[model samples]
Target: MSCRTVASFISLFLATTAAVQAQTELGNFSNVARGGVATTFVTDFQAIGINPANLGRNDNARVAFTIGEVGVGVGSQALTRTQLRKFIEDSGEELNMAQKQEMARTFTSDNVLNLNVDATPVAFSVVLPMVGSFAFSSRQRVTTHLGLNKNTAELLWLGKDAPIYPANFNPATAPLVSEVLEGTSIQMAAYNEYNLAYGRQVLSLPAFVLSVGAGYRYIQGVGVVDVRSKDGQLEAYSALSPQFNVDYGSVVNNPSFNLQKDTDKLLQPVGRGHGYDVGIAAEVGKKLRLGASVTDIGQMTWEGNLLTANDQKLKRLRSNGADSYEFFSELADIFASGTDSLFQYKPAQERKASLPTKFRAGAGIRVGSRLEVGADVTMPLNDVAGNIPAAFYGVALDVKPLSWIRLSTGVTSGAGYGMGIPVGFAIATKVYELGFGTRDLRGLLSDERPYASVAMGTLRFKIGTVK
Candidate 1:
């Protein structure tokens, strides 16, 4: 019943980040993560979100199925590989004076930190000669983004020890938090998605083939938090499933507290909505392909456990500072730690937000039977809670050195992320497929500016033939 409920909520996210995962757009396809190019490359059930038209492409398989495929990605502009690895190895370890200063300086920069987990519990697809291709898929996604301005970062990292705090400062006389922390925001959302799709060949010629597809998705929202401080103001809205078990402490007794407190199950959802995807693809001869798609064109309404922040001046400091780079703990301390919280909260009845909608297009080419190359561009259509902050561009190549083994690598940039080199390999046969990959190889080998990610699949197989 203490403020630790909120602390626990944030710690859960940080722990998940420390333990696991990239943009959830790549879904559970390890090959898509490796290539960083998906629009024209994914097929069958893998195309559920990327480009459904790929389902109608002339692939060798007549039936494809996969289960329990997963991907986890985590990245930070302020933490390096060494720091992240050390944090994971021994989180919350005390820091030396020099290390403290170093970390303080590092925190005083515009920072973008994120964690993404995409899991496809089950996916199946069938290619029919006259009925085109039909597919169904189920996925669970956890996506988060955190942005911090210099002043807010320094305060969160150093707490009362920050140099900006006067030696004789009094909370009663301190400047309003709104006036001090600008351009600081956090967003987290988890949801379950069920998709149905159909694709058919619309045009066929000796030299060209064109396909069109559409998809319908049912979404169950699990949790959502959208917080932002800007221009001398703060706006915070949140709705979490009872599964999170957040305790508001004495706030629950307040007249405004109407948040749902009952739970039916661990995975019970708090909101529901629907979305659609439409795509078109064309193949020129045996070597060239191009495609485009727009996805997640819908919104969700959160009616459970809705709360908004009441921005005010700082009241008290509960802790000196966080021990390590676990800023979420520090954030929890600053925002809602029992009586020491700088601000309070009130309940709301409902809220609505858009999905992470984006437009994608790409081109791919196959050379001989051993090499394929692709390029893709993704642009966000709305600045939603889960959408990427900027456009993304990538080029990837797949090399088949053996009939059953494939290697993939690519270079990707933009989307508010640094340059990354993706690498992966897969063992594929007529009836079986297994693969592992990363969106940024530097995360495994480099000490500076690494992006940690891993995507893999084992329960994958193909049956029957197109003919």
Candidate 2:
């Protein structure tokens, strides 16, 4: 692929992938403070994906709604904060031999890039005297992860100019592409989710109130891509929307190329599926709360514009080399080398993959009406593309010094990316709410690799005081 084509594809990938995180609940930035301890604290429509049981608890308002709540996060440990900034600024300076060697070494390690986004356009919920609570929500989630192994990293960083490619390289005697580039991968998915849920009080005893709830989700996928190489074997799959306008070139003549002419200007759905969420929550004397839930019990079958990669041996390095600062374009050059390249595409009919299903449970205690503390644990039920790499544990605190001002902070560990400290601020009232928060406050201050995150909302309101 030409550098221009690669650049275009990268831009589209980044723009459309503005969906959300691997943790479904984390997408609801409105409750970002309780993201680490959501089981019991999340309520109203906010609890739709986390723990529906919370909906059973009586809300202060008979009706509640929210719009324009968004969360976004992106980070990488591959390059330090300063180094990344310099690269992006692109001074147009040539790298010295020593600097190039250092970079080549730095890129050889297992480098990872994570991009996540979640936006809730609207959500509504209402409580009925004897009918319990009912809620509906529309959410968009997109997540992407890119990991580069040693060989893949070197090729992108040093290009064909790397020492490994011998002074005089020959395509006929060159090593197999699989043997050269092992342990690299890219996974991305974008989709829309609509949820309908119900929760009701099941038991009420003076000091104890127990509630059970269930939620149903309808999902429509927009695009998906999965590529990996391991043990001298490579596999790739993609089902993208026609809006991307990807050029398959002469490969269209290949029998594996299944072309469906879709002339839609709007982002069309490429796949669809459904899932269910169930939970139970209990309150003890209005001070202590406990809850547990399971979510995303389903799978997506991608068929729209499906394309799979055929394992091919490396033939030749066409381009002279990519500019050092043009990292993504270089990646495009590597992956989109047309036929006889490492990734040769053929048309596919369908591919099925599971959602990032997870189990979540937590406990919280309220100290009077101003101080609250909580702890939570989450584990993945399936090893899907969006699932956390490991179990997660967190402890958090919320302090309300004024009737309208609230502050939250927490310490978290696990979930693949080491430790983090989360913080948030909010102006909350019985009639409405507004807030902003981040999953990790330390990331913003880090000099080395830093992970940046932010979640905020301005349009949230409550109506009709519950009687």
The candidate that wins on TM-score is: 1
> Given candidate 2, what's the lDDT at residue 247?
70
TM-score of each: 0.90, 0.87
Model 1: how far is 361 from its true place, Å? Answer: 1.1
Model 2 clashing residue pairs (backbone)? 19-117, 19-142, 20-117, 20-142, 256-347, 257-347
Q: Write the per-residue lDDT of candidate 2 for residues 1-467, one digit (tens) a residue.
A: 22233345445545433443212237655355544667767878888888999889865368999997877766566777666555545556666556766766666644466667678899999999988999999988877667777767767666666655776777678787667778776666778899999999999899998999999999998777676677988767777666666676665666655564567546578788898999999999979999999988889988876776676666555543445655666666677544323565667777888988999999999898888888999998975556665688888888999978889888877665446778888888887888888777776678666666778888889887655
What overall lDDT, based on C-alpha atoms, would model 1 receive against the true structure? 0.76
Backbone collisions counted per model = 4, 6
lDDT of 2: 0.73
lDDT of each: 0.76, 0.73
Residue pair clashes in candidate 1: 21-72, 21-73, 21-74, 22-73
lDDT tens digits by residue: candidate 1, 1-467: 24554456555665665555533347765554544688777877888988989888888379999988888777777778877667555566777656766776766544456667788889999998898999999998887777777766666666667765787888779787776767777777888999999998999999999999999999999888777777877877777777777776666776665566665666778788898999999999999999999988888888776777767885546466666755555766665534555567677777788888999999999999898899999899986677787789999988889999988889988665678888888987888888888888775677766577878888889998775
Residue 292 lDDT in model 1? 95
Best by lDDT: 1
